[model samples]
Target: MNALLALILAAALALPAHAMPDLVILVRHAERAAEPASDPGLTPAGEQRALALAEALAGTRVDAILTTQFRRTRDTAAPLARAQGLQPQVIEARRGGAAEHVQAVADAVRARTGTVLVVGHSNTVPAILTALGGPQMTEICETSFHHILLLRPGAGWMQLGYGAPSPAPAAGCL
Candidate 1:
């Protein structure tokens, strides 16, 4: 009886000891073409910033990536996607600030990946955070650098804050 009880207790303790997702990176699209008439592609500065962000995340284990269906957002995630050797999974652009889009990505990340990066826009990034069960006011400001937001499976989420990734020395400017 004593041995059986000990085994059961050990299994129970080990259950929660399994690996959990560590980090979720939320990035707003970099500076876009000044004129909306030209279509929103990342500007030269934006491209430089994207490359810098990718370099900063080189050491992280990025299992998956998510982005909206926009040129700037896609371009912003491109470098990181290439570094991870994985294609960015573009979530359907949210219509009417829908929650389903956020839940779908969250569910996919929770079940399939250990770490996921989501690229979004200035207007909707905050909404995405809220939809992911974060606070309504969890605002990760739009910046050239990346913002690391941490979310546990069962526990609440928190913003791990920002990482500054200026353009590489060879690039000369950010």
Candidate 2:
């Protein structure tokens, strides 16, 4: 983690004045349900988790919410968006093209000022963090839905947990 913080600090220091965002909070979509195979929404527990997410971020004045078209991602972002009174900007998550999608989200985030909340999938969250100038992150465990990656451009970052703790990951998992 110290390595990551060092990298984050180095990246922040290297950024030009105009490029730094006030803050960027990135997380994997809250726990998903078992219905609709195409795009499942949140479960009852997930709903609670979403509410917990809103509460956890209540102190931060969020300027924007970014979500994908999938129901899970949108659902994960809904509570916070409602609390902040801002419509989530849809940055489409293209299948088989995660790199492009990651870059797009990172670019959109950098273009914006103030706080930005990004609700992404397990597959994308880590990459997005790295794109946002943090270290390369490990994949979030499939059952681990409670971690929050907070980035303060030109300052530092923290990994926090929100809501009920998720079940433990398998050995060697992140």
- List model 2 lDDT by residue over 1-174, tens digit each: 999999999999998776547999998898899889889999999999999999999998999899999998899889989988999999998779999999999999998899999999888998999898787878899999998999987677888998999999867556
**CA lDDT of each prediction against the hidden true structure:** 0.67, 0.90
TM-score against truth, every candidate: 0.66, 0.87
The local lDDT score (0 to 100) that residue 157 gets in candidate 1 is: 76
- Give the lowest summed-lDDT range of ten residues in model 1: 165-174
- Candidate 1 segments exceeding 4 Å error: 1-20, 35-39, 94-100, 138-146, 153-174
lDDT of 2 at 99: 94
